[model samples]
Target: MGIILEINGFKYFAPLSSFKPKHKRLCETIDFIKVGIYAVINLNNMFPAPLNLCKAVQIENIKNEHYRNLVRAKYRIIKQKTEQIVNNAKDVYNHKMINDGKSKLSQRCNDFRNLELKCKEYSDKKK
Candidate 1:
């Protein structure tokens, strides 16, 4: 005799008999697909996102050595997708920062020139 449970609306049909190998295999497959999709979609690193999204990401971390290599293969694909997103974000942020810095510098230079001009006018008046 065994029991089943559900967490956060996700169903878990646990049966007795030591959980047959076939059942384990199926679960592994489900985990791989779910996690891969979540990781790739939320590439911004919004992991552990909403319950539904979490369920998907958690699938990638499923620890089952029996299918370790297979899971790793799927994970590699998701990793590449997420990494690309992260790189793109970094590039955008760097570009914006550079532009903002240039703008500030230009403004400062203009202000300095105006001050210099005003000083020259004062000197001319004194002369």
Candidate 2:
């Protein structure tokens, strides 16, 4: 035989075989146990300790789907902003290189590629 207990919107199965004789007798006397168990244990009194930093951080990160979507959207916005900045910098650098005319065409192209690679590296590191 087993008893089903509901607590905090969750159901827990506690078999009679697992309980002591005295506990079984106590449970059997409860009339409303059939409907649903209540106040079998006070969870607030059971734990007075604070969670560790890592556990707190993990719990904090457990967001609902809406919150997760918002964070993802924010990240995309920031990434786009960074990319725009990088593109503008590239344009300005290319203009300056063209005006100076000291570098060969291939060298200017290589420099632009290096600048793009640096921007990508920065974005990756930010992520």
Residues 1-127, model 2: lDDT tens digits: 2222332222322222222334434642211111112122211111111112112123237478775654454344434544443343334344434644464432333243334455456556666
Score residue 89 of candidate 2 by CA lDDT. Answer: 35
Name the top TM-score candidate. Answer: 1
List lDDT for all candidates, in order: 0.34, 0.33
TM-scores of the models, in the given order? 0.22, 0.19
Give per-residue CA lDDT, model 1, range 32-117, as digits (tens).
12233222221111111122212233444668865565556555654554444344434333343345436532322223223335
Quote model 2's TM-score. 0.19
Total backbone collisions for each predicted model:
0, 0
Best by lDDT: 1
